[model samples]
Target: MAISSAVQGVSTAKRQRFLRSTVVLHAAAAVTGLVMVLYLLAHMYGNYKVFSGQVAFDGYSHYLRTMGEPLLPRTGALWIIRVVLLASVLIHMYAVIALWRRMRKATAGKGGRRYQSRKNPRGVQRTYSSFTMRWGGIIIFLFVIYHILHLTVNAIAPGGASESPYERVVNGFSIWWVVATYVIAMLALGFHLRHGFWSALASLGANTSPARRRLFNQTATVLAVVITVGFLIPPVAILFRGVGS
Candidate 1:
């Protein structure tokens, strides 16, 4: 009785602490996600300007750099947002890693008790979402890193990357192979978002009831389509129409 009581007490204490930390981390992720979504939307719009030609695309980038420049010389708005985004991504990764390790430990501790009984744990399964949880996240993380390096860091982009965003995109996409790579990555992003977008709402408390969950799922679907199409437009335009003067 005493051992069980002690274990119960410890469990409750740990639960309380875990909840507190999760609440803090989740709030940070949600807020930063919304902010990052805004930046991504703006970026998609700017890239979409490729329809008009390189000048229009590059001009849009210049406007982004110089917007509220001398007045807000800190460039604080954009850089600050980027920093927050980085932090949020770190926190998100840590949370998942921590949870994953805990689950792994728990699985190891099971001692094959169920397996020994020959009850098919494999046959009796959970939802599709449960199956994809581990690998899907890793895939998305890899893709996000590639995305940041390709555009944000301007490292992997084509010639004149820093001097001209338009040229970087055109030269990169004109290769055909590079555009195919992006298309593949975006298709993966579409899959990741299929589950993630709705799940995020549940975490953020938007999916309170069954009806709310349905609405949240619909909203997530729409947002996912918007994001996928918005990103694909610029590359499609560049493929059909030649780039630059």
Candidate 2:
């Protein structure tokens, strides 16, 4: 009886701790998700300037530094936002990992529902969105790595390039394969954003009911389509123009 009581006490404590952790993770997820979406959209818009060729695009980026004020002091606000975003992303991922471990522990030995097991043998169940979320995250991670090398690290490119943003970018996208990868990455981003955006709102208590969740899901779907189109248009135009080629 004494041993049984001790085990039950531990279990209850674990459950309570998990509930608190879940709340924290969900909150972080909501905040980070919103900020990241905005950051991505801005980044994509800047990249779209590449459609006008290297000079135009590079100039656009240079102009962004000035915040269109034509001033000596660059916009500190932009850099501040970027810093905050980086910090938020770190916190968000940490929370997600914490919650994931807690979930695994809580669900251990529980047989999932039959339909869920069939759909997602890996988890309690796989929602359609869940399947793509993992894939999309993978693509994004890969792209971020390559992107740093090409754009960030100034790695080798089609042209023996200097680190000049202009030289680097023009040389970077000059390859068909590179451009193709950009397209694929943007598509994956669309999938990930589709589920993430709405789900974030839902996590934050924006959509309380099943019907509301469905409505928000449709909204997120539309936003995803917009983001995909917004990203693809400039690249597709550049590809057709053979600017990089």
Compose the digit string of candidate 2's lDDT tens values, residues 1-245.
99999999999999877756777689887789788888888887787666566678778766666773544358665567768987887877777667667666777935233443555665456456655775787788788878877775677565457756766776656567877999899889888888888878978999988899889989999989998888777656555655555
Question: Lowest lDDT 10-mer window, candidate 1?
Answer: 109-118
Show pairs that collide, candidate 2.
Answer: none
Best by TM-score: 2
RMSD of each: 6.9, 6.9
Deviation in Å, model 1, residue 150 alpha carbon: 3.7
Off by over 4 Å in 1: 1-32, 109-134, 157-162, 242-245
lDDT tens per residue, model 1, 94-208: 7656655665687784412232224555444333444465576677678778767776678786534655676777766766776776776666555556566676666688887
Off by over 4 Å in 2: 1-20, 68-75, 109-125, 156-167, 242-245
**Per-candidate total of colliding backbone pairs:** 0, 0
List clashing residue pairs in candidate 1.
Answer: none
